[model samples]
Target: MYEFCPHCGLKYEVEPGYFYGAMFVSYAISGGVALVLGFILFYLAGDPGGWVYVAVIAPAMVLIAPVNFRFSRVLWLHYVAGIKYQPEL
Candidate 1:
């Protein structure tokens, strides 16, 4: 969660509440993770009980929280905000 990028001196937040969109991105990422994990567990685990999904998906989301947060922000910045990489800058 840098206020600015050290390598390029680029400010991370373009405006107030800029990152609010990132929350939705994070939600989408999380939902996708849960669905994928649930599907995998459903098939590989031989269609275990409902509690099994709750048990596995809960911890898996927690474990991937940090990665999901950063990834969502990066996705928001690169896709929604139209921030382009300036390799020369």
Candidate 2:
């Protein structure tokens, strides 16, 4: 993670432990993914065995982790930290 934005020199971490909230955001994202996947598996796939879910959803979560991590922090920064986008800046 960057300590500061390269383009604008704004600190990524606005305060001590500011990113801690991002963890919850990430978890929520993960849970939402899992819930949607589970719903699909249950309805579309006829609720395959438990191991099928483990095999599928586990890797899916892992695969999305990088995107989830970044997006969650960005959301936390914009939505929670009230950092507005300034394209002119």
Candidate 3:
């Protein structure tokens, strides 16, 4: 079930125990987004007073949690599935 890198479109084989990198990528994206939002709120409020941003965006994040989960898997598979795409017949 080796795959290709979607970002770079590089075809490569997935080594044993290699899929874990996808989880890291997903977490990095999600957590980075949250942190950036938090920083912006704090900066604009002159303190941590703008919790409304967190309250609103946090739940939105939760709602999209499933999407994020699936996205990670799909991203990994895109790289590791080794499935090639061809134009329609």
Candidate 4:
């Protein structure tokens, strides 16, 4: 990623470990996905085996990781870092 925002020239790396907080956001998103997916699988699949959950959920999480990663960072940037979009920039 760029060290600073190309639009407004805002420094994205505010500190040595600024993005660490994004991990929590990612965790929350992933947890929610797993929980909801679990419910769907449990009901739709008629209470499948534990291995079935692992087989499906693991790959789903892996497939969504990249999107979840960027989403989490964007969320953290807006909510936690207070970064806002500026069309004028």
Best by lDDT: 2
Candidate 1 per-residue lDDT, tens place, 1-89, comes to 99998888889899999999999999999999999998998889999999999999999999999999999999999998798997886
Best by TM-score: 2
**TM-score of predicted model 3?**
0.52
**On TM-score, who's better, 3 or 4?**
4
C-alpha local distance difference test of each model: 0.93, 0.95, 0.69, 0.91
What are the clashing pairs of model 2?
A: none
- After TM-score superposition, the amount by which residue 43's alpha carbon in candidate 2 deviates from its true location, in angstroms, is 0.7
Q: Least lDDT summed over 10 consecutive residues: which range in candidate 3?
A: 80-89
Error of 3 at 75 (Å): 1.3
Model 2, C-alpha of 89: deviation from truth (Å): 2.7
lDDT of 4 by residue, 3-45 (tens): 9877678898788898999999999999999998999999999
Deviation from native of the Cα of residue 48 in model 4, angstroms: 0.5
Candidate 3 local lDDT, 1-89, one digit each (tens): 33765666655545666667778867876887788877777787665545687685688678767788768766776766755555462
Alpha-carbon runs more than 4 Å astray in model 2: none
- lDDT, model 2, position 15: 89
Please list all clashing residue pairs in model 1, or write none if there are none. none
Q: What is the lDDT of residue 56 in candidate 3?
A: 55
Over 4 Å off, model 4: none
In candidate 3, position 42 carries an lDDT of: 72
Clash totals for all candidate models: 0, 0, 7, 0
**What would the per-residue lDDT of candidate 2 be over residues 1-89, giving only the tens digit for each residue?**
98999888999998899999999999999999999999999999999999999998999999999999999999999999899988987
When sorted by TM-score, best at the front, the candidate numbers are: 2, 4, 1, 3
